[model samples]
Target: MSQISRGLENVFIKTTALTYIDGDNGILRYGGFDIDDLVEHTSFEEVIHLMLYGDLPTKVQLQRLKTSLNEAYEIPQQVIDTIYSLPRESDAIGMMETAFSALSSIYGEMWNKNTNKETAIKLIAKASTVTANVLRAKEGKKPVIPESSDSFARSFLSASFARTPTNDEVKAMDAALILYADHEVPASTTAALVTSSTLSDMYSCVVAALAALKGPLHGGAAEEAFKQFLEIGEPERTEEWFKKKILEEKSRLMGFGHRVYKTYDPRAKIFKRYAQKLSERSNEARKYFEIALKVEELGIEKFAEKHIYPNTDFFSGVVFYSLGFPVYMFTSLFALSRTLGWTAHVIEYVEDQHRLIRPRALYIGPLKREVIPIELRG
Candidate 1:
């Protein structure tokens, strides 16, 4: 007899060199390098290179990669026209899926086996550029072009906001991107991989990933966390909010507990610092950060006994708020960064051992019975 693993909990799927996680100890690594080290010493572009190529790039290699990303950044104006045609109050995640599917329709014929890398670079750059355009279209503003001269975060912010981001704002955006770049076989990435396992194109895989990310269990934790902070309204109200939500009602603290991490999420630890540093400069951001700190403390005190702890989503929204993004854009930014990992994994899957990812399902329903004549059947 076979037993079902509900939700595929603790299932091992395939091997990867992209990322590593030790959830029990709250560790996350990309390409064998500690996340703490990456956050301190590397840029988001470097992290992207590491996830894609499995090694840190030399200065020449880095510059070449940047040139490739820059060169592939342009999208046809027809694509922008589609974005403008959508309803302005539309969901960003759905808009992303629709956009990528449209992109696949536009570029589908261009992708063959050999051009996957070029396609990957194109999709990676297009993810952010198109997302910014979607936001601009919603606002009835002209789409701003990304500047290859600036870093990816700076370029993305400038395109979305139509103004140059401050150096510090760029730094925070950079950190958020790196932190969210990949999480080993996350549902969104796996959705992309599952699509790729059948030899689908990269844009199709991206559409799959965006669809997965739109699920509540995957994408909106950080956004929900931010909403809770605003509901708490101030630092002084943090304890009351925490108690009413977590202790009194036995409800979750949204971003506090993780299915994977038994200890504090290492990414959260890093983001808390970013939130603090950034909060010092922005009064609006500072208010949310204050509530986040109190929530973290009270959450640990109340829930750590159960090995529940804050995950990466805990403070990422505070950082995003500091960088001046609207709340709806939070998960779109996640899809943008994770598209790097999605494209990378799809490439790896297509290049290696091949098989359909079909799994068996357990059946539990009515037992079969002999059929009677139609007139006699009840």
Candidate 2:
């Protein structure tokens, strides 16, 4: 019998140059650049270039990529009509998947060495537009036209909220997008790579990724983690609630632990700062931040021996909530940021190897037996 690796744990299917993770040290990097350095020095647009094209872009190259992205930001009118026609109560990420799948009508093509890169750029560029419009349609609001003059972050924010964002808000949004642009190969990335392995178009690959990301264990964790803060209500009640819901009842704490990182998620560290800074602007945000701090304090104290620390989802919801996004839209925002990573991985995998990802299962059921007659089976 073959050894069974449930969930394909610790499986290394192939090598990737996109993102690197040192789980033991809680270090993350993109295209050989340290995550901390990238977040501090580079905008989301620059990170997009780095992930797709390899090295950091020069001033001229960055400008050109930005131009290409801005040009592709406007999704087709048919896609917009599809977005408007969906039920208002539809899941945001589900709507995003549908929108990307709809892109197949126009952009879908068989694997082509010449045109694949251009298709990747278009998918990444339009992800934000698709996400923002999905949110608008959910609220029965018309789509906001993309402005080529606006930066990537500004473009999404202005359209989503129907208002121009302040410079500080734009900076925060950009950093958040940069942090989530890529992370080695999580489940969603794996799903995407699997689809791309079969030589599917980039849009179809992203749709597969989105389907995987819509699950609670993956992309929905941020929304669930933030709900814990809301449930705790007051900062002073955190201890009692932690004792009742976590310690005594043994309920799982959503954002406290990670599968890979033994220490604090480096992305979470960056998000904590943004959460703190943005929390100052809103009374509601300040209250949630306070509760989150208390929960983290207690969580670390209890789980330090286990090496289960906060992951990226810990404070990300707080930052989004602070920015006035609804709780349900959390994962959709994640999808928006992660589209770059998904497409980057898809392009790399398809262009490099293009092998189908099929693994054998260890069957443990009883050996084949003769089927009994229907009357005798009972």
lDDT of all predictions = 0.83, 0.88
lDDT of 1 by residue, 241-271 (tens): 7778778898777887777788999999999
Clashing pairs in 1: none
Tally clashing residue pairs in candidate 2.
0
lDDT of candidate 2 at residue 97, scale 0 to 100:
86
Query: For each candidate, how many residue pairs have backbone atoms clashing (under 3 Å)?
Result: 0, 0
Off by more than 4 A, model 2 = 375-378
Give one digit per residue, the lDDT tens place, for model 2 in 234-330: 9999999999999999988888777778998999999999999999999999999999999999999999899989889899999999888999899
How does candidate 2 score on lDDT?
A: 0.88
Give residue 20's error in model 1 in angstroms: 0.8
Which candidate has the top score in lDDT?
2
